[model samples]
Target: MNNIKKSQLFWASCLALLVTSLSFGIRAGILGKLGTDFQLTATELGTITATAFWGFPLAVVIGGFIVDAIGMKRLLVMAFIFHLLGIVLTIFAQGYWTLFISTLLIGIANGTVEAACNPLVATIYPDNKTTKLNHFHLWFPGGIFLGTLIVILFNSIGLSWQIQVAIMIVPTLVYGYLFSKLDFPVTERVASGVSTATMYKSVTSPLFIFMFICMFGTAITELFTGQWIDVLLKNVTDNAILILTLTTGVMVIGRGLAEPIVHRFSPQGVLLISAILAALGLYLLSTLTGNAIYFAAFIFGLGVCYFWPTMLGFVAENIPKSGALGLNLMGGAGMFAVSVYTIFMGGFYDRLILKKLPAGANEADYLSAAPGTEMANLLNEAKNAAGPEVLQATLVIPIILVVAFTGLVIYMKNKKKEALTH
Candidate 1:
């Protein structure tokens, strides 16, 4: 009825994120089913999964550049269309190419949501980027938690996977309606008339570059690990859905509670602590078992809950001149890292499975390795041992982040003191 309210746009954005995250939850939940039905290997599945991550950066970067020209509303509309189409195609996906192309479209839609919403939030709440961005991102895990439960519920009732996916159509249409009549805002960069050259310059700045590079590790730590929760925990537990829900549940709650922490500590301070917990959590997941694994997952969720949004928030606050391009590139860089790691991990899992199982093991044989028996014990042992190895390798990224973010914390601390003195 009136011009768009920031609150209206924010919830619309949350719904968009919920759709994106629900896709991920559904994809993760169906990994085993997809692999079995399609007769695919881990390497093949990884290749398919990589499409989602690959398409995101491409769209986000391009969307970043054109968002100001086309308007955020139009960009979001495109995202909605893509989201709808991607889901339809995914439901009908018959094989590798079909799934890949469908997922790639969905990935683009997901990136579009971030490209539009990240800057949208920053523009609307300029004074509180970190805290608000954290709040804005809370929906990501919240969606995942909800989606996982939906899948679990559906599975318990012998529902089809297609139905699980089709359920997302509800949120998709709701967001489309919410955004349809609302007016949109001009981007922060455009309102300020930040020159194109200035945007590029900010992107190339050393600080921006440092943050960009660090995003790769942070993205992989959260997304790559998260996207594979079902497969990774398949041998560890019967309720992978519950485990997925639990990890994301912790993230939802952790992020929900982040305002006070963000208030007390600087974003860098928060990031520093997050990196420590992430590394420790990954190691624990790799090394520990049974109940301890759940604890480790909670820690890991807390570690990553702030990384993506806070990184964007930091760039928004610290690199105001960079504008939408900076935010888009940060998101793009993270997804790109996720794409690379997904492929690498998938291939690694394929190789690991080969080493563990007999040379000619088939899908039935693989699935037959039950949880409590000898073959299952061997399978679980192999997964636990090999699984942690990949996680341990990933630990190197956060360990390095610990050092880099510490330097950032000190630098920001000094910068703040200098401002106070001035």
Candidate 2:
């Protein structure tokens, strides 16, 4: 790559990562306000949040063909358009349905970027796939950090979230222009005379199936938290952005150091640790009265910092010849994992009602509390009408799921090792 084109690709990747993270963070910061502005029922709001993942699966599946048929540069430019348009549409949304539609589109834009740029990065850094992939992924949290700053600043300035969301357009335009000037990689399969149909079947292998489940947990850790933190933390503190900031800050730092950690501990070990921290983080964040929430957020952020991007890297490292199709196949499966987690969590959320009324509180009081309100508030005054120990039991499900997932990842690595030795 020429120096200027290299720079273009560099900025393009950074800005793409930025836009992807901002998509969720902006939603997190504005969700409360959007709920009030649009008179959304909890059900309606859940749909809007869930919409972000709806297109991810399709984007990944279609991206394989798109990247090969066109080119990475062109596809990335298209992704930018989707993101920019999604943000633009979001700013003008006047009702719950409108917001849901807009978020669905943003999900597609973000998913296409995953399809295009993941392979782009690996092709650009073939000799250092894991290291460069980590570097590329650092931008996801870095963008969240940037978006959070805007949320706090503009929110203080009384910029309605509509206006705040509109600000992201500048970076979108910048990235689009930069990507337009670059030359993206050609398909390795095409270069070697391998056909596209052969590439698609490679994603159906047993190894890919195991990795797909692992990616699903990765989505729960990243999206379930990124999109819902403000709602989740509302139970603990009024300052939701502070918690989001802390989480993203930890994520960026963790991913920044991921290159070395993967070298030392291996990705599977890191993933194992990530799972434990994620579970603890959810447990702490769920309980409002304790100081453990902060520590939990920190630990959870550290664990997930590299989980999403690294998994994409794992597929590439393990299946180097799979090319853009492999990357997209892995990316699509990862997003599908996220969509499933979101849908599953949506089902489980109603199960979290406060059931064991603390002391004097009535069920009505718990029902009327704010979005993240804790059950402890009932305190002898409220009657808990809901299931007893709601989160107490449901959260264990995620922990179990994540732990077993880590083992599957290890199994993949071990199998690869055995194949190599044989």
Candidate 3:
């Protein structure tokens, strides 16, 4: 432990995570522009977006299995190479296939960062897993806030989306340099002398399997809505990007103050409450209009702020024997679910708009219609009508979460009682 530089290593991990999140924030901000420029349908755009989600799980799950053997430094090196390649490819992207490949590269880089960092943080701060993990993860929202603000700033000045993406390279290079020079400690599983077989066995436990399933709902509720916010809320809000910015800003603050909150409610209690607030927030977003939507964004941000980190922290603290595999598996599952749902939601949104069009109107009728023509007007109206309905349709996820988290809370309580009795 004395050979390792803890503060320097931790901050470097934060910076690496910042780069990963910047990719998410920037890609989300540019989604509409890509669609318009490439003449893509909502479903096609969704497929491109889903590539990142799916690619993420692939890297994280694979990286999880080999991280202990290959070491954190090697994994981060892979992230650095992929980040550069992905950014350059995206800048030169011509159409659907190019965008899909580039976003997948970036997603792989993003997942690799998490695969290394989550276990790294857990290893260094064994005394305060949940609170410290929350602090470490604040950067996810913090970086998103910065990314959205960059988009707003660049767009306001008539800058190209390509330029917005290029800004990520600076941070990528910085984190790459930092990790290159630093010495890394062993993973928590190795440090604690837990056997590989024991770690494998632990992940198959009932509680772990339960949480793995629950992660799908939690992630889709947060990431799916966030990534699609611009399109989903464009008709409902004046500046849909601002809604994303505001929510991420609120999340940064909430995660920063997580220690006391976790102390008061415990992780299970917080998850239950977060599920309730998230459901209410989404419902409000579906029904609210104008300035009132900001309030809903705030609530939504608060609800999801602690979800990702807290979930990881719970597994690390309770199932220590499961090690890096458990942590990465949970994250990988969440991302995989989001990938599948992204396409579903996009198709669903497209279908809703199609259903709302007049009987004789086909998609071509709207796309080929000249601006200011009656067909164009009808298409606009249909989009406006379908947007809120799309949000309403997503409410089922968080609503189900409310029930699921309640059960988790009760289950944890019983487990605690049984432990005490023994």
Candidate 4:
């Protein structure tokens, strides 16, 4: 790769990722506002939120399969178009259906960014896939930090949410400009002359299948928890925005410093440690008080920081023949899991209002006393009533991850030894 094209590709990928991350942060910051403005039940709001995830898997899976065939430049152009449409539609959204569709469109755009960039970066830094992938993923948290900070500042200054949404356009335009005239590289699979059949076969291999299944748990553990921050943390602290910012901030730093860790532990070893820390963080988050919550957020951030990138890195490094198809399938599975969990968790929160509330807690009184519209008040009350139990229920995910990854790690170790001996 020429140095100029390489620099252009790297920076453009970062800028694109920043756009996706900024959208996530903005959506998270405005979730409650959307609920209030639309008078939405928690379950309805969840459907809207899940819309993004729904669009992601569909686009990501399709984009991954066709990205090599159509080229990354075309996919980048498609992403820009989808992002533009989604953001404009979202700004004008008036009801659940409109909001859902808009968010779903945006989700597809987000997924395209991943589908295109994952292989782009992998192809660019073939020898250092793990470290460079980690480097690329730092923008996920960095963008979150930037967006969240912007939201906080905008709110402090009495700026509208529409304006906050508009801020994403800046990065969108910058990425588009950077990518406009750059020549693109073929995917590693295409460049290496690996036939499509071989890539498909690799995906069905035992190792690839194992990693695909594991991806679901890791994605759920990381994203499902993040989706709940604004709701759950409200019951625990007044600094919900700060806590969100701080968590992603830690993730930015953790991912930024991942080179040494990846070298020390290897990808599988890192997954094991991340699983353990995530479980600990979730358990701590379920509690009511103390500085431990901050500590828990930090731990949780560290735990999830490398999961998505490292998972992709492992496949790129170990299952090279699987190519873009493997990367897309992994991403699609993760997003699908998050989409399913978002609705399930939302319904769980809604049900908890009746299931766990003190007998005769007076729904009307709760509604009247809480802030915002009726739906918003009801949802907040439900969260306040059941946040801890909901968090407790989520603990099962990471526990399962720890156990699953432990066996995988041991298996990988034995496999490595066998290979060395051969």
**Candidates' TM-scores?**
0.93, 0.86, 0.97, 0.95
Q: Please give the TM-score that candidate 1 achieves against the real structure.
A: 0.93
lDDT per model, in order? 0.85, 0.71, 0.90, 0.86
> Where does candidate 4 stray beyond 4 Å?
356-381
Candidate 2 lowest-lDDT run of ten: 379-388
In candidate 3, where is summed lDDT lowest over 10 consecutive residues? 360-369
Query: Which rank order by lDDT, best down to worst?
Result: 3, 4, 1, 2
Model 3 TM: 0.97
**Top candidate, metric lDDT:** 3
lDDT, residue 130, candidate 1? 85
What is the TM-score ranking, best to worst? 3, 4, 1, 2
**What digit string (tens of lDDT, one per residue) describes model 4 on residues 64-132?**
889989999999999998998998889888898889989999999999989999999999889999999
Expressed as tens digits, the lDDT of each residue in 319-360 for candidate 3 is 989999999999999999999999998899889889989886
Q: lDDT value for candidate 3?
A: 0.90
Please identify model 3 stretches exceeding 4 Å from their true place: 2-4, 368-370
Residue pairs in steric clash, candidate 4? none
Candidate 2 residue lDDT tens string, 54-142: 77668867987778788877778778878878898898997977798889889899888878888777776766777678888888888
**What value of lDDT does candidate 2 attain over all alpha carbons?**
0.71
lDDT of 1: 0.85
**Per-model RMSD to reference:** 2.7, 4.3, 1.3, 2.2
lDDT of 1 by residue, 1-422 (tens): 23348788888888899998998888888877787677666788888888899989988999999988899999899999999999999999898889889999999999998889898888888788888888889898888888888889899999988899899889998998888877888988988889989999999999999999999989999988887877776655677557678889988888888889988887889999999998888888777777777888888888888998889988998999999999999999999999999998888886676577656755346655555777656655666556656677778888999999999999898998999999
Q: What is the Cα-based lDDT of residue 4 in candidate 2? A: 68
In candidate 2, residue 383 scores what lDDT?
17
